[model samples]
Target: MTGNESRVAIVTGGSRGIGRAVAERLAADGQSVVIVYAGNEAEAGKAVAAIEAAGGNAAAVRADVADETAVRAAFDLAEQRYGGVDVVVNAAGVMPLAPIAELDLDELDRVHRTNIRGTFVVDQQAARRIRPGGAIINFSTSVTRLNLPTYAAYAASKAAVEAISPILAKELRGRDITVNAVAPGPTATALFLDGKDEATVERMSKMNPMERLGRPEDIAEVVSSLAGPARWINGQTIYVNGGAA
Candidate 1:
């Protein structure tokens, strides 16, 4: 592949869910992928194997997205293995539901450590090291807009993500790097459906005009577009939730 066509990417939390889909999509789009996971080395290996089986270039790296040193090593692996980083999708995050009245501070801390601090750590690296024309995509939630009752802490963390995306984009003025965030609604990922009952899930499905839960591939499509040809879409928080909010 030509240099421009063979862009390389690092997808955090890429061992599962929307991140897994994003890794596969980017590889299918001709980018060499480095799938970054917080843990789950086996799953990370599986993701790499799937990409290789599909005749795409890929590797797996383990790093806590909130840990600066680990994140640096992950980026180092991407640069060392795939030549350089062209796209960084900060898809690593946590979502623990709780109302403000019954909030669990420890869980909130854990969520923020992974979701909010993680974005900051990862994006700081992307800002410092990503090549010109690179794209940095952070994951957000439609819950921020939907204002769902039990997602207070999760949405608050993502609100910080939304705040950082545009600010970083503006900071990268002449570098041609685009920093953006993708806010997804009730996507059919284990992370989203884990605690919900069938009735609750169905109710959420009805919130959007589409009357269905979003698929991981749906969100992957948006990431792919932003990472590749969607140059004009800089510093934007795109809601890919099918009119959920």
Candidate 2:
């Protein structure tokens, strides 16, 4: 509740890729946005500028998703600037590919810290502060179902994320707030395409029934539905992977 203004949204990792798309789409939908990024402040600023250019209100804040205090400050900024938050998209995540046997413990910890712990931190803040009728969207990955090689630890962490989404929805019962996870399949983001060769990308793309990599906008559209006008669709993980999983 604005008590009457446009609802505010906090999109973590909003500086680039899918997160950037989510921020833009939500702002375009008429909500004031806080684009939270762990780094790449320049990209974050650009995301804010893009929203402003589109006649939407947005601000960028820097915060490590796993850091509770910094996340709280980001929420504080949203409240101060836009009145109160009504949506939170926890899209901040890290993926370092390795099989379980050879996986670096440090890398696993980092991924888990940002993926599992980060979701928990952001959800905690949203659960505490979001106005009634709000939505909390967390990002998981289709790899959990795909069982792809070299994604063991990454999948494991996101599996934890998937496991918690519905639990939080129940916890927020009677609050009229919805909690859900969006598990995207292989998408054409820098994070996904950076290391692979074109053939590899092609193979992954064809894995989907659609026979193409999911576009950032495609995923953003799903987020828009959840963040804005999809109140009845709560506590479920809507896999946006084109049935690859």
Candidate 3:
């Protein structure tokens, strides 16, 4: 990629929450963005519209991140639309909270299917397609370090993400592409706020020195850096938790 070239990006789970924020940030930074959603066409359209309204190039593709064929089509669209893909952010994930003893097998499978297999499928495509000087950013979670109760299934899936990212970075040795994971702590997204009561949210908020849940934009800032100028920061999992962990 040349200095004058505009980077192109594919962001999985780009319809809402942190993923949406990342997509917008990348677009704002002059990258052509393809917002990939599992089923939410409305949300995906909104994200694309928002980016376009801001004078950035964007499109939305509906695809299951765990489905290889669908993900490949998404990549093919990005390449066809924006010349070539320069970055991919695997922010697609599922979090089903349950204690180890009570966790249902079906729920475990659902969480792993999305969080583990989904990440792998997307990262696999990224490894095969992203151009040199590009990046693959996967999402992990601070729960892996917090050991929070009732997060066993969710935490385990993210632990796999943290493990695989560095190995993938090394595997792409001469490709000049960077691979890394961003682990966010208690962020204020629908995914994080859905089941918890006000009291639980309050407790988690204070756990961080910042005394509040992280904003999607805060995490996006780090992702923006990794996707662009932070070329040397490879094969690592960055904890964006305001020192919570």
- For residues 1-245, write the lDDT of model 2, one tens digit per residue: 43457988999989999999999999999999999999898899899999999999999999999999999999999999989999999999999987889999999999989999999999999999999989999999999999999999889999999999999999999999999999999988998988899899999999987899999999999999999899999999999998898
- Residue ranges of candidate 2 with Cα displaced over 4 Å: 2-4
lDDT of 1 at 191: 97
- Residue-wise C-alpha lDDT for candidate 1, range 1-245, written one tens digit per residue: 35565899999999999999999999999999999998899999999999999999999988889999999999999888878899999999888887899988999999989999999999999999999889999999999989989899999999999999999999999999998999999999999999899999999999999999999999999999999999999989999999988
lDDT of each: 0.94, 0.94, 0.95
Model 1 clash pairs?
Answer: none
TM-scores across all candidates?
Answer: 0.98, 0.98, 0.98
In model 3, what lDDT does residue 91 have? 91
TM-score of 1: 0.98
TM-score computed on alpha carbons, candidate 3: 0.98
Candidate 2, residue 100: Cα displacement in angstroms equals 1.6
Model 3 agreement with the true structure over 105-182: per-residue lDDT tens digits? 999999999999999999899989889889999999999999999999999999999999999999999999999999
Q: Is candidate 1 or candidate 3 better by lDDT?
A: 3
